[model samples]
Target chain A: MKKLDEITKRMPPEFNDFYRQRIDFIKASIKNYFPDQIDKDFLDRVVGQPSLFEPDLKATYDTIFLPTQEYLGRGGKVLRPVLVAMCLEAYGADIRDFEPVFGAIEVMEDSSIMMDDYIDNSLTRRGGPCGHIAHGYALANVSSCTAFALSHYLFYNNELKLPDDKALKLLDYMAWEHIQMAFGQIEELYWTQSNVNDITVDQYLQETIARCAFLTFRGPMRYAGILADAPPQDIAVLEKIGEYLLVGYHLKGDNLDMSPDSPEWGKVAGEDITTGRRTLLINYLLDKADKQERATIESIISSRTEDEEKKKVVYELVLKYDIFAQTRDLAAEYNQLAKQEIEKLSVSDEYKLLLNQFADYATRRRSL
Target chain B: MLHHLIENFDTEFLEAFEADQRTINECFEAEYKKLSDTEHLEQNVIDEPLLAWDYRAIEPGLLELMDPFMESESHTPLLFFSILRDLGLDPKPYVKASLLLEYSYFALGVIDYFDFHKVFTERKQDLLTYSELTQVRYAAQYLIQYPRYLVIKNSFELSKAQNIALHKLYATIGVTTGIGRGAFLKWGHDYFVSLIREHYFQNSIYTLNNYFLFPAMLGAIIADLSDAQKDSLQKGFSALTMFAKLRLEKRYYENQDEFKITPPIYRDLWQLLSFPGMALMENGLQVDPAPYAEDKYPWFTGLYRDLNTQIQGIDMADTIKTMEKLETELFETFVSELGRVDLLPATVERLRNCYRM
Candidate 1:
């Protein structure tokens, strides 16, 4: 696994500098926005009564606040927030003006991940116990519920005090995106729970778009466009760009799941297989493998085999079928398409170049 | 004679009210059929393992459970349609929108029930397996959003502004329910205060207002109702919602087994009921259970009278007396407020029946 610095070093110097500046600000801003602990006075205001017993504070911290920080502190790529700012910049809006809403993206992502991890029964995330495992299901679940509610604070309590019409539109957009996300999760859960293997590439792609793409790129990008009041045509272009980038980004992450050093980068090698996730790679392999090979792959995926030897066999099949190389090409193809979409945008050359660089970084990044 | 309460009212009013019920029930049946169809995924089978427990295999049974459970909460959807019809607007277009609202609220209710019972009671274990609990939750998440897709797909009839209102309505409900659920699970003075501030003071009110007002807002915009008319309708529906929630909670409080109520839980409930109005001022929050609340907020006074009654478990005849008095007073206030509005006679009767007055 590459160090964070090494990953940045691989990016073009200009984009690297741009990414670092905004990424640092996003990280710091998220840190500043989430309170470390709930003080007694803060509790009093929320509870509405004068007398708050001491135990409530401890319970609140244990159930909601602490578990939330533990999960958020594990560090994500902050890709969504960065994309939000970049989209704002493309529209020639001052990203600083919308700083508060950035945490909205982060908390929403954190909240979704915590819930998703629980649903999937994942053991590890970002090289630590999944929230549900680290903090019992009750605490993890309640904390996630809190995070979901608090995600709205960034928009509702924005320092700018957006006009009612605009504010309503933004909130509406977010809700619609969230509803789409739930549909996405339903399909993914159903596919795995049903142990369904013959998932067509289109079926797989649509699920990925709904589950990962919308929240990760499309939603945040459109959110920025709406906030900037970008032209509808440009916003449409941004949406396509986000969709393409997500396809590329998601495929690359799938390939990384089998990398030997995935654990070093806070991923479990073959975790998708064990969880029976119908990734594009798995679907592609299932489609192409011979009768015996298909049977073997099916057996492994359906059983959620934990045997290293069995996982290695699936990895060998991946190589024999050249699935990784095919995935890389597909990812590259999508990344190029994303870059092409960016060219259609009316944004300035610098912003276009930045968007294109990030497009490359979508597939080029070493770690998931 | 009591059952014929609406027979003496205008025929058009009765027809509209019945039509709303029929449409809501139709929507529920449609959603139920779609969810219970077991062959949803036929050709996409991974070689069936020798033994595998599938969540989908039990979906039919779950829907069977969900069907009756949803029917029991039918009043909420009725209230929505009643609000629209009472305001003299067509409730047809927003029937699906009301379905979206219904599923959203019910989904959150299921989550609250599961999460709270998982901690507080072992009784749910008899009713649902761990897998059933989780799978039901996943199904709920799907149920909540499927109607929104229907709304969007059928968007030709809706204006962009109306669509935005629907979105805001769903989002506010989701956020507020999350706050309410979190607050319900955590027991502490601070947690209670936070719950009061976030859930009651802000989120819950926003949610209830949205639920009651979305139809009115859409109807007003469509009918070109004057602002004064809109304001009057809004006040009536909001008041009705407030009273309904208070009544619902009062019933829940009535069912409270004192043996199950621990020290902290008991104390928290007590403080919430007896919280001094001035304490809110000290905390920079004003207590406003107004318009319906005359001297003291009905929430405090209504619950305070029966504070000891809960712990006494109705064993003492005095306990039941206090409880009945509070119930009668709350019902009278609700009926009085209903009278203040310009609702059709049938709409008012439906609400009385729906709220079990």
Candidate 2:
């Protein structure tokens, strides 16, 4: 079977600048809003008066935003906001008008990633030390809250002057989606920590729609579609694309995490096995493993074993079953569905091509 | 006088308060059960006995999730109702909001379980039992979002301004909790200054302000008070909250035995102060630096004086007098409308000792 890296597609040169500009725009937006040092003016804006007397402003910034600042500095794809910008362009709106929305989406994504790392006790994120490891766990914990709040603040205080009804709808949508996201995470935790042992690929996909797809895919597209006043049908199309693309994107991530050179891409290879986390590959393996094999896999996962040899054993078993190839094919099917959804949109071919390129970059890219 | 007020709970008033507590607990359990049902959380899984379920292996019960909020000896809900009564407002419509406030407290408690445990064992090799830490930590990730969900879900019952205010209120609660906790972990050698700074900034004042201001802020929003009146209300409550928080801190430090069953952070603070920090501000704690520490390092001396000046400037006698004045001018007439003078002293004490108070 072909390995993941051998089939992995690189971001096209034309699309490289497209992605870079969005990342830069998001980084600039963040810096513009959260000043170098937090002060009364910023505090008054984010959290209104009456201000505290003699607040340790420096301490507040250091404790709250500094870790986030450093983490955002490490730079992921910033694709959620990019997706938002894409939806806006397709709907004939200027992205510049919604800069705060961009900041909100990116910051919320960062906050979730930070919290994920903290919960998983991950050692690294974006190729460096995790926020909790780089900063103290205390700063990381509180910073997550601060960053989450800052995202809402950015959204509410957006300068776009959106109509009240639309604003309210968008706010409610974000909240409901977040609740769905939370439940998805909790359910996944249940499966990870429990002996239920019956999570099918279908069940995992449903969970992924909530856990991975909503925030990463549906949210950005829907935010732009709603803000751009796109018709409900178009919004539905974009949502479908998001759902399919995110499943493909996530399964691709699952496959990549097991690939031998995943470390070159700045993530620990076979980390899913080491952490005993549930993944598409592991689900397939469990379905196929006999009684003894199932017990070994279950024990390794349940114990969250740190032993190198045991992790190697799981890795060998994964190869024995050709699980990575099977998961990769599963991911490709979703990616194809995403492209088909992209084709259904009434936007210009330029927008479609951009989106198709994005899908490729999202699900097929070798690096983070 | 404080003990007299606290110990002598009026029997009729006690009955009324207990009735309120019962009503609130019923609402919490019902809502929680509904939420679990909506989420399809297995009932049998949550109902299994604690010993039978491994903290690491099994998902915690929805019943356990509600336990820290419902079963706590907190008087926040009752005092909130009393304060609403004292303001001449109908408290019935806002019961759900008060319920959300209790859940908000529960959410914070979830975070605090992790925060305090982390701080309590910052330097220890075995920080916490791995399972317990993961369970609580992951619980907080979702639970922290619960109150905000309740607010957004119940938006029809609230005005736009009220909805916005409540959202900001939750965010501020989170930010303040983080700031206060982060301060403790990164507390510098200028310990008192750090502690006092954090307290005023967002630690105690902002944290405790959210609770006192929860009801009052709602009152102001519902009353359509001008921004100035809202600011005035906040200012008044700020001073009161400061005094109340100081009293609570003193009580916390004094009650070392209470630390036995609680998270180790409290005991660790006591040990750290009693040993290396070289100061034990024990009973008869007057918030005076001289009574606690006698360090003569020049920098330390300056910060010590600053801490002393800050504490000394807060004359509790004057605070009490001001509070009495507000009771008469601001609250007495409205409270009289309830025609329950027998409930007054207990209400006053309970209000003083709200969620954090």
DockQ of each: 0.12, 0.22
Alpha-carbon error at B197 in model 2, in Å? 4.9
RMSD (Cα, Å) for all candidates, in order, is: 10.2, 8.1
- The best candidate by lDDT is 2
lDDT score of model 1?
Answer: 0.59
Regions of model 2 farther than 4 Å from truth: A1-9, A20-23, A260-264, B1-19, B39-70, B86-88, B118-128, B147-149, B188-202, B222-225, B250-357
Q: For residues B288-307, could you state the per-residue lDDT of candidate 2 as single tens digits?
A: 34432432211222333444
Model 1 DockQ class: incorrect
Q: First chain TM-score in every candidate? A: 0.90, 0.91
Cα misplacement distance, residue A365 of candidate 2 (Å): 1.1
Candidate no. 1 TM-score: 0.71
> Which residue pairs in model 1 clash with each other?
A46-B193, A46-B194, A47-B192, A47-B193, A47-B194, A48-B193
lDDT minimum window of 10 residues, candidate 1 chain A: A46-55
For candidate 2 chain A, the 10 contiguous residues with the lowest summed lDDT are A1-10
State the lDDT at B9 in candidate 2.
Answer: 34
lDDT against the true structure, per candidate, is: 0.59, 0.59
